[model samples]
Target chain A: MIKADYNVFDTTHDTQYIYRKLLDCMARPGKIQSIQSVTRKLNDFPDGLSTLLAIALTLVDREVSYHLISDQSNRVHNYLKWKTFSEQASIENTDYLFINQNLGEDKIYQLMSLVKKGTLEDPHQSATIILHVDELSIDQNKRQAFHLSGPGINGVTTCYVKGLPIAWIKQRQIINSEYPIGVDFILTTTAGEIMAIPRTTVIERKEE
Target chain B: MGYVAVTGGRTAIENANKLVHSYRLKDAERAIEVKEIESQMRLLVDRVMGEGGLYAPEYAALALKQTEGDVHEAAFLLRAYRSTLPRNHYSMITDPGEMRGIRRISSSFKDIPGGQVLGPTYDYTHRLLNFDLRNESGAVEQFLEDFALELDTEMDTPSFPKVMDLLREQGLVANRKIDEVEPFDITREKLAFPAPRSARLQLLSRGETGAMTALAYSSMRGYGAVHPTIGELRVGYSEVHIPYPFADEEEDSIYIGELKLTEVETVNSFTQNNQGDVEFMLGYGLTFGQNEVKAIAMAILERSLETQGQSPTQDEEFVLLHIDSVEAQGFVSHLKLPHYITFQSMLDRIRQAQKESKVETGSKG
Candidate 1:
């Protein structure tokens, strides 16, 4: 008898709304979407955990395994396990990896390298890395800007981010060199904003 | 004249829906109750349960009444309802040999264990309709009272051994090692060509009964080479259990409930094994509720798919893709939807071709 708390988020309607937002972002890479309205209704979650929890509650279930990085106290991990009934797996075998932006660049690189890239036969088996970042904006004033051109974009679209490491993008490029066999990235902010960079998208750094 | 798109289509659709409701209530007789349909139309409810792939009898009855007794539409409703649900647990593997059978029979042997108890079947009944059912309120109670006296209440219910087991013991049936691999769930994953046996079985078990019967009939009528004898057909209740989530021991499980099922095992022609020993092949089918025809047809088509042949029934993709009632009915019924633009485009192409042909004929003359 697994008891789950439903007060913070509705299992049906909330998850459905979050899933639709995530799907829209995934389809149009570099497109920013906000779920602040939904997350604002939630309370008592630590800084940045509410947005990540919203995503986890939408995608994570008993069918998949997840790994949470940068949670030294395992609070998020335990809550996720209790709420979603999902098992905690190692980085390599996990289907979803939730990473905090505070994690060092070196650790992020190591984790990204070890994550599953799937196989030629079943590319959908690949892992999805959800990274908590500071901010995502369409304005070019942010610290780093990426010009994305892919199946989802019309031709090229530039998206700016504040706290994501440039090295991680390079590592993603290397891992995704072989088409259709790579991890997808969903960058979420503390303010409940999200933008996706699917493996099909080609990202290039825009010079200031 | 060019096809003109209408503006009041929404009002028309709304009125059409209202008209459907009106038609359902036009009869002066009382509206049929869901419970009555479930209990009185047992076989029809069973057919919907099998085809809809949902075992909720009350919900199946509701779908039947809502669809005005259209089995296809009722099944579509149930399947659509099933999609909104979340899958929480996978049940433990069940064995049909443990079923408490209400009806059991075997065509391969005249006298078998359990002695062919034909419980609540119309097989031996005449096809003629009796007028007595028009006013059957008193007859129902009287018949039940009379029938109860004839039943042997003192005897304990007997369990029977599987007919296939006897053949296996005699080395007459081919040896098949138990496949312990986790069965593929067709609902979770999109089906691809050259599907695994688990996916094939999942699709066939919930397939449309009339379509499956027709395909099986085609095979029997010389379209294919599979003709099988019923090894055993059993309609019974089977228990379902799920692993307890918080249990410390692996053996700990919770008994969820029981389901009424129809299981069929068919014995086919002999085939040589890798070592050149000849043995009879087998086809198996199982579905929710007591749907004997669907179960038998499923067994025939299951075996037909295994054989290498040019027949449509032997084509896995052809048979499996077309057998889904919801998919088949949806595709066919979608033709009734507006296709004005497409038809207009086709008409334009034909008119241009006619003009070009006329110019060519005039120039040649």
Candidate 2:
């Protein structure tokens, strides 16, 4: 049950606009879009959480299920269920998995592996993973720089994403190698910039 | 001048809307009430409700009036309105067998336990328009009086047993194992390919009537292999049930009024189940109101698409994606929206191609 104060503010217009941004990000992988936080008054969450919460409100509903991997308390889970009306699913069975920056390399690896790789017949049955981070940059000097080349990217797009485990880029490659059966990702930063990396995108780790 | 600006068309847009309203109300006749439209143009109302994916007659009628009888526009308005509403609770699985039958018939059997009740239908009626109704003032009152008199004697007895139960008893129909799987709501999420049966049914139920009929006709006309016999066609009101709030298994569900639904259970050719036993497959369809044609078409199309065959009707994406009136209307009507940049680019490309061709021809000359 959701608290009375937990409100999905202006679900018709704001939520739809946020979804459009999410769709655009998904369609053009590596393209960052801003999702304005409308329900910031509800909870004074951590830095990058407002956007994640907004996304939960926009996309998650009772028909769908989500699993939260956050450093925040179980309040986030209750808030999501209450506001979005989405069912709380296990890590293996979730449609959307929210992964905050707190998870270590080992936990990320284990969770990524456990994430549902939908069957060949129904590739869309796979989970969409939303990772919340501090910032996203395209600076070459960054340690977490990635070279992406795939369906959405023109030729090769190199970018830096903060708040993921250093080994995550390689881990994503391994998980998504089978084509179509892998989980898609939307990485949101504290600055309100969100970038998507679908399963079709090939993510290569760029050494500093 | 055609204004394209950051701040323009405020007054022009306002007048343009006024212009539309003026056009809609141009007739100097008496103002048409929504209730009149709801009762008189019931088929149209039903079509709009089905396509709109909402079952509100008053709303559908108002939408029709607002859109000036444009089916797609009316449906779009209803759909847009529906998007603003919050979902309270999902109705429990409704059994069509429990429908208080107004009109019930089965094409497969000569006679059933519940005899055919061909209640007020146009099936046998001549297509000629009644010119007498044009000047008729007390037509509505007289019709109601006659209907009231008829209903006094002709009210159907309780418990209209379903025709399918007879087949089930004889083991002709496929054994239906009751599963507790929740039906997917197609309105909430984007429909993915190889969609579940529940999602497919939901989409088909809300699909445009004409689109569904055309597709079903194509299948019958040899595009796909499905020749269905309507096991039962029922049009009546069914009670909508929702789980009692915070109630346990012992608690009876809550009844949230009744909705008029058209239901069809089509029996297609027998096919072997996974166990290699011959069992007749049933295609089911139910939609809002007295929409028999669409319901029948939907039942046939539902069966045709269930096999997931390569044929046009069998292909889920081709049938399901195209049948949605709102989606079809939006995609088709969006062309009317300003595409200035795209048009300019296309013009540039055409001119560029022409220039290149001319250059080649000039050099050859």
Candidate 3:
């Protein structure tokens, strides 16, 4: 029987591996690798995003509320609700919002506008976005010359991203200018490679 | 206006699982049976069962077999398995007075009422390996013939009194009551201090033998001071305690009767006077399986840990806290998981540090 196990006391070997990977992912802002045991099914997610599921499964606990812009079918929403026991929320009242290929500027802007601004009492209460981008590479979009000069970036780097929106980059830059108040991102390709593009990193897209 | 489509975390995870599976099983050519560990490597099985906090020796043997003799893995297996089974009934509290012992001896007196029945023991047996046992065609007889008797039949020896009990009756040793006071169960609840000797013994009994031994050794060397004597060492099946449904769990939780396990209980003697004439009973340690040395050492360490005025071993919290195999194993194996995120932050810090250092060097140079 496929049971939705939520408790830490009932941890499995693979679950522990997933848990550790999640910790590693969080500890470093924008670097991505595969977490253990999650599998992708076609059309289940709009962006075909499975890593979102992995992250949601790992961290979207009962205490948190999640909203989806791309998954209107509520397959992702219901699945997360059942599997991780996370509460469904509107864009207006959400701790986190998961967006993918289907979401446009209006939806993202609306969601971001509703996010609670960081307060002195709880800065972590602000909304975080787990944006799935298409194609992450160190040498992608040479004109943009995306230099990854953050904590995990070994040195200055340029990467090409095919599916990521230009406005989103501008939005990200605007948000990140506030430091400690910007939303973080995880960009994944169709091939399943990940490069964490956190709020802290600077990206200059080419061919404007 | 831009719409970026990105997300496929599931595929990465599936491959990681495959790698883990290959790392564990596919590489090994031959798989070993659990029975071999239970039968041949009995001592390891015993230690695993003792430390695992599970009384079932057979299951412990099976885990040891599966883990290829890794004690921590075996312990983790036991822990994982332990939480799965629902606690059916709380066993009655068995008294040491009602223990049916096969091997009982006292260091103070060579000849007691039971007359020292050293059942199956390695004590006095030469440590050298015997080559003749390699080609045994038939069933071999017991090394000591007289001790072996029919199962379920009582030995003709008189009912013997506990060495500590005798000492207490004489008014020559410190008196502590094992009466109505309930000893805390570590498994059911979180441990609180200052723990009673009974609570300490409960912890010591379930503790890993090696870790306990190291703590005891440390205490004996410099950590704690308690010149211990083996007042009595008994190995036999004792009655287990199961709480009756009708009885009070607070005041009288355990109802007594003969039980399921085979354990060795050791009683330690602590000297109270300089002349060493007047003495005190330190504590009792009982663990599942036949680990007499471990049992004896555990009792000694239990006493030394309680009173840490002058000895390093006296620090009970420090020693008892680190002696858990499960905790140590979990903390150590956790490192095998990824730390890319933390490393990224470290990279940033290193660049910052190097820049500052370079600036200082430039100023100096």
Sort order, TM-score high to low: 1, 2, 3
Candidate 1 whole-model C-alpha lDDT, 0 to 1: 0.88
Candidate 1 per-residue lDDT, tens place, A29-144, comes to 99999988777656667758888888888899889988887654277777776777777899999999988757677987888889999999999999999999998999866677
TM-score for the first chain of model 1? 0.93
Per residue, candidate 2 scores C-alpha lDDT tens digits across A87-126 of 6899899999887757778888898888888988888888
Task: Identify the leading candidate in terms of TM-score.
Answer: 1
Candidate 2 matches the true fold with a TM-score of: 0.67
Error of 3 at B112 (Å): 2.1
Please write out the lDDT profile of model 1 over residues B248-333, one tens digit for every residue: 69889999998899999999999998888899999999999999988999999999998899999999999999999999999999
* TM-score computed on alpha carbons, candidate 3: 0.54
Which pairs of residues clash in candidate 2, taking residues 3 or more apart in a chain or in different chains?
none
Model 2 misplacement above 4 A: A1-208, B1-10, B154-157, B175-179, B248-250, B273-277, B308-310
lDDT (CA) for every model shown? 0.88, 0.84, 0.65
Clashes of each: 0, 0, 26
Q: Candidate 1, which CAPRI tier? A: acceptable
Model 2, C-alpha of A48: deviation from truth (Å): 21
Native contacts conserved, per model: 0.07, 0.00, 0.00
